[model samples]
Target: MTIAGSDSGGGAGIQADLKTFSALGCYGASVITALTAQNTRTVTMIEPASPAMIAAQMAAVFDDLDIRAVKLGMLGDARAIATVAEGLRGRDLPLVLDPVMVAKSGDTLLPDDAIATLRDLLLPRATLLTPNLPEAARLLDTTPATTEAQMAEQGAALRALGPRAVLMKGGHAAGPVCTDLLVTAAGITRLTAPRLPTRNTHGTGCTLSAAIAAGLARGLDLPEAVALAHGYLQRAIAAADGLRVGSGHGPVHHFHAVWPHV
Candidate 1:
């Protein structure tokens, strides 16, 4: 299940997550914490769901579905974050938390104040916390890492904060190869892939996290899940140009494996 915001553009947030879950052969469920009036170009407006409604949706989903794992994204505000934290506190499932603070178009989705609330309440409970360079810097109150060493350092710092593990994404870093560090208490495993040239890279973060969650749901271990999800996103990004959904940074192809060549 994905606990997130809804993107009307059918790209990032809940839409991308659900698409990823389905494409990866998992039954998808959702609890919307907010709604965004957005397209690939930019986010124009955001309306957070009331705490009651958010809680209700979570309860309803947990009440019936035999959910195995969860992916969290775009919880709009402190209230929504707290509500989600409360709903997930006692659940014994793998939680893939994606710290979604900014959109591909450079719009801020999370406010400055709410970052504290999220770190305090949700960080400790996550099975895997995935944060891009900028989001990681924001969470740690430091500048974004420019090199792999710094990324490993930041990942260690974040792990010390309480999550079981952290996946430090290096998409923001400048290089021909994109490297993602999977940091655990023992050590860090660097996963690298060639950076594909494509402007349609929206929802890349959401899709990766959701794919990892789907792998976990299918009984794969952390390393296995991360590997599969990493490869999946690489292919999705490589195929992203086939889609002409929008004028700006468009979405990665979630159904790259299943859909006929575009």
Candidate 2:
């Protein structure tokens, strides 16, 4: 299940998660917690779905589907987060969480109260928590991470907050190589790739987390899943390097390999 807000632009949030899941050969499902009037350039408005309606959607999915894994995204407010958390209790499934605090256009997706509930309830239940440097700093209530060593340290600190593992993404940091650190109760693993110089990077966090959910549904171990998902996103970005969509940053081509007859 992809629990997220709907992006009318079809580039991020639920749209991106479902596309990534399907491209990775998994059946996709979703429960929208909110709807955004957004595009690559900006989020003009947000209308959060009521908590009751959100719960109903989740119940409908769970009652009918054999959900093996869950990819969680934008929960609009504290009530929505609490509702999702309450509904997910006692389910023995792999939960891949992308701490989606902000949109690519720099709009806040999660409210302050929701962030607290997420750290307390949802983070502990996550099989893997994926957070970019900025989100990690916000979660840990510390200064923004500026170095690889700080990334690793924050990864460890975030792991202590309850998730079984943490994927600390370094894409927002300045570097020749984008390093992603996966820290588990078992050990730490680092995966790096040359940063693709492209504007087609919208929905990257959603794509990565959804890819990890697809990997988990396909029965990969945590480290292996994370490593493969990182590679997948890197390739997608490179393949979309020259493609243009909106006037602002475009989205990574989900069907890059299959389309354009390259």
Candidate 3:
């Protein structure tokens, strides 16, 4: 299940999560925290769901269905973070938290006032926390990382923030290869793939975290899940052009290997 915002463009948020789950052979469910008016080019507007409504959606899901894992993304405000955290209270399920901050087009997704609430309330509940460079930086209240070593360092720091494992994405770093560092209670594991030259990278983060959550639902370990997600994302991005979506940063081809689109 994915607890996130709705992306009208079907390129990110809950749309991306559901697509990733389907591509990986997992049944998906969702509780939308907000609604977004967006395209591949930009996120034009975001309207957050009320706290009561957010709580209701989650209740509707938790009361039924055998949900194995949940992925979170684009929580719009403090109330949303609190409501979600409260709804999931006491459930011992795998929670994959994607600290969505800004859109690929540079639009803010999370309200500035909610950052602290996310850390204090939601961070502890995540089984795995996935954050790109800037999100990790904001969570740490520091500068964005620019190197692999720095990413590893930040990954460790983020792991300390309560997630059983933290995957720090190094896509923002300069290099031929994009490395994602996963820091866990045991240690850190680096998942690397050759960076593809593509403009269609819009929903990469949401897709990866959703894939990881699906892997968890499928009984993979944290490292194993992240590795599988890394491989999947690499293929999706490499085949993104096949989707033939919007003109800028189009959606990745989620089922590039299986159930290929005609």
Best by TM-score: 1
Worst 10 residues of 1 by lDDT: 253-262
Candidate no. 1 TM-score: 0.99
Cα lDDT of candidate 3 equals 0.91
What are the lDDT figures for the candidates, one per model? 0.94, 0.90, 0.91
Tens-digit lDDT track of model 2 for 72-178: 99888889889999889889999999989999889888877678888998999999999999999999989878987898899999999899999999989887898
- Candidate 1 regions exceeding 4 Å error are none
TM-score of 3: 0.97
Q: In lDDT terms, which candidate is top?
A: 1
- TM-scores for all candidates: the values are 0.99, 0.97, 0.97
Return the TM-score for candidate 2, rounded to 2 decimals: 0.97
The order of the candidates by lDDT, greatest first, is 1, 3, 2
Q: After superposition, how far is residue 197 of candidate 2 from its true place, in Å?
A: 0.9
Weakest ten-residue segment in model 3 by summed lDDT: 253-262
Task: Give the alpha carbon lDDT tens digit for every residue of 69-103 in model 3.
Answer: 99999999999999999999999999999999999
